[model samples]
Target chain A: MKKKDVLLKALKCAFPYTLPILAGFWFLGFAYGYLMNVSGFSFVYPLVMSICIFGGSLEFVAVSMLLSAFAPLQTVIMALMIQARHLFYGISMLDKYRGMGWKKFYLVYAMCDESFSINFTADIPQDVDRGWFYFFVSLLDQSYWVSGALLGALFGDLVHFNTKGLDFIMTAMFVTIFAEQWMKEKRHFSELAGFASGVIALVVFGPQRFMIPAMAGILALLYIFRRLVEKMWETGEDTE
Target chain B: MKMTLWQQAATIALCSLSTMATRFLPFIIFRDGERTPAFIRYLGRVLPGAVFALLIVYCLKDVSFFRYSYGLPEAAGIAATLILHKWKRQMLLSIAGGTAVYMILVQFVI
Candidate 1:
């Protein structure tokens, strides 16, 4: 296939997977941009932060950080805490992302939750270029977010409608993805561990600070149960 | 805003730096050709499921069950998503349906 043909094919294959993200990112990004605008910052803040930070949750948190005192150290620590989950994403993508040359850097840079979820799970056709497929997925998802942020920052409060519960789109997306993963996997230990740990952490730590503890709990439980978990996979008893 | 222009820049820069650090650290630590530890390899396989689950919870963490609406909108929206996804197996359809349901519920019902 020609280079253009390959790139086009990869984009074509990748675009559908990102359609759901298109909606989620646009709405959430718009909300972020709108929030930043109302909070006394210019559109440039959302544009720059969305492009640079790229992590949706962290960018929103950064907006609040920017509103507060000039605590650069706190900003860094908060960012690391909020984004620690990307560590799991990076670890998972290690073998998949290796040897992609220059693209590897952007791939890692754009490893947000949406991009990682699609890239990690999507079963790309064998003939398609894996690198380009991953690249377009990351690029398209980011573009939706950045463009949405820009739009919201520019025309946020001016053109307002009832968008109250639109943020639920994100939760819906995650739930669907979780269900999809559940259908694919044989054993449910990891899934249960994730759900249970997250719920426990949320209850114990409250909404303000549950992620770190939830992650720690998940990691600890996974580590403690490694022998049994590995045995389950090894025995293949749960194979569908 | 209490922050100076340079302070804002520094804060954003620090955020970008730390976020990148988390994403890049694992690959940096376990480079190509050098064997990745067995434990890390096992985690790479199983962690995605748990991570997705965590993300779902993260998205809904702000819901106040003790307050008004008591998370009914979220519950109904998730049900719509779950049922739609199970029945049709279409990603966009499920998300759209669930979101629309939540919007209507919160805007009108609740």
Candidate 2:
């Protein structure tokens, strides 16, 4: 196939996987832009930040960081702490993204939760090229976010609709992914450990400080049970 | 904003730089051509299941079970999502249906 044909075919195959993200990212991205606009930053802020940062939670938190006292070091620490989950994403994607040449950089750069989930899980057709499929998925998802941010920043003041619960789209999406992952895997240990650690850390540390501890706990649990988990994967049987 | 334009630019630059660092570090450390360590590979296999669950928790981190609504709306929304997903096995429908249900509950019912 011609390069153009391959690109088009991959884009066509990739579009459906990104549909849900188009909704979720636009809603959340628009809200972030609107919040930034109302918070007194210009539309330029959200436009640039959404493209550059690409990580949703950190972008929202950065809004406050922008408004507060100027502390660049603290901002770096906060970004690292809040966006630390990308480490897991990068580690997981290492093998899958290995041979993409130049596109690997952008794939890693645009590795937001939604894109990662879709790219990681979607069983692409045998005919579709995986690299282009990943590229289009990343590009399309990022575009939805950037466009939504621009729209909201440009028009936030005029809209007064109640979007009180639209944010739940994110939660619903993650829950669905969790369910899908649950059904795919034979052992539920890692999933349960993630849940238990998250809840325990959330209860002990509260929302503001739970993430780091929860991650640490997950690493410890998974590392400690590496043999058992590996056995379960190999045997596809409950090791417990 | 209290900071100068340059300061603001620098702050945003730092934020992006730090975020990309996390995303790129592992791949950098585990370099493509070289053989990846067995332990890291082990993590690559199992972390997705745990990470997604953790992400779900991250999304709901702010919901207060002790508050007025007491997380019932979120609970219902998640329940709706699970049922719709399990029943239809359709990703978009489950997300849209669950979100719509939550919007209604919060907008009028809750």
Report the Cα interface RMSD of each model, rounded to 1 decimal. 1.0, 0.8
TM-scores, all candidates, are 0.97, 0.97
DockQ-derived CAPRI band for the predicted complex in model 1? high
Please give the interface root mean square deviation for model 2, in Å.
Answer: 0.8
Candidate 2 on A115-196: residue-level lDDT in tens?
9998898889999999999999999999999998988899988888788888888899888888988988777998999999
Off by over 4 Å in 2: A237-240
Global Cα lDDT for candidate 1:
0.91
The docking quality of candidate 2, as DockQ, is 0.87
Residue A218 CA error for candidate 2 (Å)?
A: 0.7
Which parts of model 1 have CA positions greater than 4 angstroms off? A237-240
- In Å, residue A135's CA in model 2 sits off its true spot by 0.8
